[model samples]
Target: MTDRLPYWRLSGFYLFYFALLGATAPFFGLYFAHLGFSPERIGELLAIPMLMRCVAPNLWGWLGDVSGRRLAIVRFGALCTLLSFALIFVERSFAWLALVMALHAFFWHAVLPQFEVITLAHLREQAARYSQLRLWGSVGFILAVSGLGMLFERLGMQAWPWAIVAIMSGILLASLWVPNAQPEARSDRRARGGFIRQLRQPGVLAFFACVALMQLSHGPYYTFMSIHLEALGYGRGVIGLLWSLGVLAEILLFMVMSKVLARFSLRAILSASFVIAVVRWLLLGHLADELAILLLAQLMHAATFGAFHVASIHFIQRSFAAGQQGQGQALYATLSGIGGALGALYAGYSWTRLGPSWTFALASLAALVAAVIIATRLSEERA
Candidate 1:
C-alpha cells in the first residue's frame, strides 16, 4: 500500500498549497503595510480572508461530500482562487483590495479542507503517514519564505502579488496530477448517527473549542510578526529565515511524528502544544528583541502547529465516520477560521493601543485557556 501511494503527487499538492501560505502568512501584512495601510486597516484587510474561512470551507466541504467529487472541488476552487487573486493587479485601493482578499480567500480556503479529505482517503489504512506527506508543505514554506525574503529584499514589495499568482498557478497544475479518492466505506454502527450527533459526543465540543482558541492565539503572530520584526530592526532576509526556522522545526518533527504518536496520547500532545503556545507567545511579545530567545520561541512551532495539527487531524479521523470526514475537516477549518478572524480583528484593534507586548500577551491568555480546556475535557486515551 505504501509502495502504491501517489506519494509525490499528493506531496506536490501540499507543497504548492502551503507554498501559497508561506508566501502569504509572513509577508501579506507587510505587503499591506507597504501599501501605506495603517495597522488597523492591515488587520481588517487580513481578517477578511480569515472571516471567509469561517464560511467557505463548510460550504465547499458539503458540496464535496454530497457530490463525492472532492478532486473536482479542489480543482475548481484552485481555479477560482487564481482568477480572483489576480484581481489584486487591478486595484490597490482599500475597498478594491478588501474585495480581492475576500474573493480569493473564499475560493482559496475551499481548496485545502477538501484536499485534506482527499489526502487521507488516499492514505487509507496508512493514515499515520499523514505527517510525512504534510511535511512537504513545510518544505514549500521554507523555500518561499527564505527565497522570497531575499527576492523581495532585492526587488521591493511590489512583486508580492505577481509571485503569489505564479505559485497559485502551480497549485492548479498540481491538483491536476493527483487522483481522487473516497473514504473507504465502514460497517460500524456508530457511523449511522448523523454529523450533529458526532459533534455532541463527549470531548468533541471541547476539542473544537480548543481548536478555535489555538488558532485565535495565532492571530497576532500571523497578522503582524513580520512588521513586528521589522520594527525590531531585523532585515527582510533575517525575518524570512526566522519564519522558515519555525517550519524547518516543524519539518523535523513531522519526520519523527509516527514514533512520537505511538509513544504519546493525543490528549497529551494537544495539551503540551497549548502550553507551549502560551510560552511561545509570551516570548514573542516580551523578548523578541533578543535573538536567542526568539530562536527558541520559533523552535516551539514544532509543537504549537506541527504536533498539534497532526494530533487534531487524527482526532477528527477517529471521532468522525468515513462518510462524515469531509464535514469533519470542514468544521475544523471553519473553527480555525472563526478563531483566526477574531484573533486578527482583536490584534488589529489592540496592536496600536496596547502595543505588541500586550497584543501577544492576550494571545498567550487564549492559549492558556485552551490548555485548560484540553486538560480537563479531552480524553486521556487517543480519540
Candidate 2:
C-alpha cells in the first residue's frame, strides 16, 4: 500500500461525489413539480443552480490555484453544500426554492474542477488509471439513481429532499479526509506565460468551443428528461433504473477507457462520441415510443458523456503547456458551466413550444456541429 499510489482512494472520492450528483440532478425536477410547480417555473428553478456554475467554479478555481489551497476550497464548497441544501426544508415558496437551489449549486459547482486537478496531480504518469478511478463514479451514479428511484416510487417525490441530503452529506464526509491537489512542482515564469498564451491560439479556442457546444446539447436531457419520462407514464423507480442503466454503460466504458485511449486518437474518440451523441438524441426524439431503442439510446451515454469527458481532460492536458494546467482546467469548467446554464434555459423554453422531439433534435444538431468543429480543425499532435 505504501509503495503504490492511492488511486483507488481517489476513485472512492469521485464515486461518492458523483453519486450525490446523480441523486441531485435527475430527481430535483420531479420533486419540484410534485411541489405543485409548473413546467416554466420548474425550468427557471432548475436553471438557477446551473447558472451559478458559470462563475462559481471560475472564482473558486482561481482562488484554489492562486492560493495553492485546493483542499480548503473543496472543503468549504462541501460545507456550504451541507448548509445550503438545509434551506430546502424551510423553502416553501417558489422564490425561496430558487434561492436555495442557487446557493447549493454554487458550492456544488466549485468542487469538481479543483478535484480533477487533484486527481490528475495524484496520477501524473499513471493518468490512464484515471478511468479506473472514475468508473466508480458511474457506479455511484447508477446505485443512487436506481435506489432513489425505487424509494421515490413507494414514498413519493417528497422523498427527494432526504435522499439528496444524505448523498451530499456523504460527499462532505469523503472530501474532508481526501488530501488537497498539489502540483508536483510549480513552473517557472517563461513556461507559465507560454502556457497561458496558448489560450489565444485558434486550435485551443476551437477545441474549447466544441466542448462547450457538447455540454450545451445536454441541457434538455439534464433538466427535463425526468419530467419527460414521468409525463410519458414511466414509473419513478423505472425511470431511475433507466437513468442508472445509462451510467452503468458509462461505467463499462470507463472501465475500459485506458485500453481505448491507448489504441485510439483523442480526436477519433471525441469525434466518435459526438457522432453517437447525435444518434442518441435523435433516438430520444423520434423513437420515444420504442422501449428497446430508448434503452439503446441510454447506453450511448457511455460514448456521449464518458468518452467525451475523458477525451476533453486528456486534450486539455496535451493542449496546454505544463504551467498552464490549472488555468486550462479552470477554462474548461467555466465553459461547461456557462454552456450548461444556457442550454438548460433554452431547453425550458423549447419544452412547451417545440416539444421534446424538436428540443432533442436541436440537441442532436449541436452535437453534429461539435463533430464538424473537432474533426476538421483539431491540430495535428506536436512532435
Candidate 3:
C-alpha cells in the first residue's frame, strides 16, 4: 500500500521544513544574545515568527482550500521565506532583524499547514502511517541541531544565518519535488455541516483550547532552554546534544506511534502528554543543573511533544471532513502560535524579574491547567 504513495517526496519536504526549525529554535536566541541583546529583546525577536504563525496559516489555508492549490501555496511560500530570510545579512539592527523575522516567518509559517493537508490527502485511509513519514522530520531536526551545535562551537556564531539560508534553500528544493493533492470529494450529506459547525462539535473547542495552553507551556523551553543550558556552563555542542536527545526520544515514539494509537485512546494519550509536560517543565525549571535529572526531562519529550503532536494530528483528521482539512490544520497552527507568542512574551518579562525557576514554574502551571481541561472536556472516544 505504501509503495504507490509519494512517500519520499512528502517526507523530504518535512525533513527540510523541520531542519530549518532545528537550526533556528535551538540557536536563534543564542545568536541574538551573542549580539548583546537583552533577554527581553531576544524574546520579542523570537516571538515574531510565532506571531506571524497566528495570521499566515489561516490566510494561506483558506486560499488553498478554496482554490484547491495547496502545493502551489507551499512552493510560493517556501520561495518567499528563503528570499526574505536572506535580508538578514544586509542589516543587524533590531528593527531590521525584526522585520526580517516577521517577513520570512509569514511565508515559512504558511507552508507547513498547507503541506500537512496535502500529506493527509495523499494518505487517505492510510492515516496511521503518518508517523512513519513524519519520523524523518525528527531525523532532520536531530541532524541540524547536533551538527550545527558542533559547527558553531568550532567556527563561532557568525555562521548561524548562513547555515539557516542553506537549509531554507533545501526546503525550497524539497517543496518543488512534492506533487499536488486535491481533497477527496464528499457527498452533500457528509459535507453539509461546514467548517464552523465541525468546530462547534463536542470537545473540539476544548481540544483547541488545550492546544494553545500546551504550546504556551512550551514557550520558555523553546525560547530559552539553550540559553539556560549555556548559563549552566554547558558547551554549545553539549547543549545541542541535549536538544537532539529530546527529539531522538520523539523519533523513537514516532516509530511505534501506530501501535500506540491502536492501544490508547487519543484523549488518554493527550492527557498523559500534558501531565508529563507539567513534570518536565518543573524539572527543567529547578533541577536543570543536575545532568541526569535534565536528561530524564529531555527523554519525556516523547510524551510532551511527540505523542501530543501525533494525537493532535489524528484528532484533527478525525474531527473534520475532507474539504475542511486545510482549515482544521491551520487553526491548529494558529492557536499554537497564539499560545507560543504569549509564552515567549511572558518568559521574556519574567526571566530577569521572576528568574528561570519561577518562569518555568509558571510554565508548569499552564500545563497543569491544560491537563485538567483535556481530562474533563475531551471525549473518551475518538472524535
Candidate 4:
C-alpha cells in the first residue's frame, strides 16, 4: 500500500465533491419554491435523493467489496449524475423531476461510501487529519453557495438548474483523476451472515444508536433551516451567508480535529456536540430573529457538525481495521443514511405543523437524547 501521497491532493478531491453539496443543500428549496412547488412537493423532491442514500450506497459498497473496484463505482456514479441532471431539462414535471432525482441518486449515493474506504487507505498514519482534508470540501461549499447566491440574485431563479449542472460538471471533471485513488486491496470481509451479529455488539450498537439520534436530531435543521431563514425576511444571499458561516466554522474545526481528537476521546467530542446543540437549537428556535445570537449559534457548527462528524469517522476507522474497512464504512453509511432518511422525514412532517420554533426545539431534545445514549452506553475502549 502506498502510505505516502501528499494529503492536499486527496483532500482537494474531497473539497470539490463536498463543495457540490454546499451548493445544492442550502438553496434547492428556493429553487423549488421559485418553480412554484408547494412545501410538500419541495420536501418530497429534496428528500428523494436522500432516500436513495439509504439503499444505493450500501449496494455500491457491496459491489466494491466483492469486486475491489471502488473507484470504478465512483466514476460510474459521476457519469450517472451528469446524465440524471440532464434529464431535468427534458420535462420539468414533478414525475420527471422525481424520477430524475431517484435515478441519479441511485448512482450518486452509491459512490461516496466506497470512496470513503478509498480515502482511509490513502490516509495511512494521519487518518485523523481526515477532517483537515474534508474541510476544503466546506470551503468549496461556501464558495459555491455564496457566490452562486449572489449570481442568482442577478440572474433570477430559472438559472438554478444551470448552476447545479455547472457544479456537477466540476465533479465529472474531477472524477477523471479519481480512479487512481482506489484502494489496492480491501478488507476481505463482506457484510454477510450475521450482519445482525456484528450489530449485536454492545459498544458498536451503542455508537450506531448515538449517530442515528444525532442525524435524527438534524432533521429539522436540514429540512427547513433555509426555508425558515427565508420566511424571516432574509434574502437568498444572506441565507447562503448563514449557511456558509456554519460550514466555514466546520472547516476550521476540521483543520484542528486531528489534534483535538488526540487529546480528547470520541465520546468527549460527541458529548460536547450534543450539549452545544441543546443551546444551539434553542437559540435558533427561540431567538432566530436576533442576528448576533444566530451567528453565535451558527459557529457551533464546529462542534455540532464538524467535530461530531470527524469523531464518527475515526470511530469507524478505529473500530474496523484494514481488513474490515468495507464493512465498517458500510455500517457508518447505513446508520447515517437509513437513520438520516427517517430523521428528514420526521422533520418534514414536524416543520410545517409545529412551526420552526417548536420543530427545532424538538430537534434539540433529540440531540439530548442521543447524548444520554452515548454517555451511558459507550466504553473507554473500542467496542
TM-scores, all candidates, are 0.99, 0.95, 0.98, 0.92
Q: After superposition, how far is residue 374 of candidate 3 from its true place, in Å?
A: 0.5
Q: lDDT tens digits, residues 15-120, model 3? A: 9999988999999889999998999999999899999879999999889889988999999999999999999999999999999999999999889999998898
lDDT of 4 at 183: 46
- C-alpha RMSD in Å of predicted model 2 compared with the true structure: 1.9
Task: Extract clashing residue pairs from model 2.
Answer: none
Task: Itemize residue pairs with steric clashes in candidate 4.
Answer: 19-141
Better of 1 and 3 by lDDT: 1
Q: For residues 1-383, what per-residue lDDT tens digits would candidate 1 score against the true structure? A: 47769999999999999999999999999899999999999999989998998899999988988989999999999999999999998989999999999999999988999999999998988988999999999999999999999999999999999999999999999999999899988775547678999899889999999999999999999999999999999999999999999999999999999999999999999999999999999999999999999999999999999999999999999998888888999999999999999999999999999999999999999999999999999888744
For residues 159-189, could you state the per-residue lDDT of candidate 4 as single tens digits?
8788778877777777667535444444434
What TM-score number comes out for model 3?
A: 0.98
Candidate 4: stretches off by over 4 Å: 1-3, 179-197
- Name the 10 consecutive residues with the lowest summed lDDT in model 3: 183-192
Candidate that scores best on lDDT: 1
Clashing residue pairs, candidate 1?
none
How much is 330 displaced in model 3, in angstroms? Answer: 0.5
lDDT of 2 by residue, 1-383 (tens): 12456666677778889898789778877888888877678778877877787788778867876787777778889889989999999957998988898899889888888888888887777877788888888889988989988988889888788888888888888887786657566554435546557776656888888878998889889988898887777888889989998999998899899999999888889899989999998998888667899899999999999999998888877666544566678788878877787778888888899999999999999999999998898765521
> Which candidate model has the greater lDDT, 1 or 2?
1
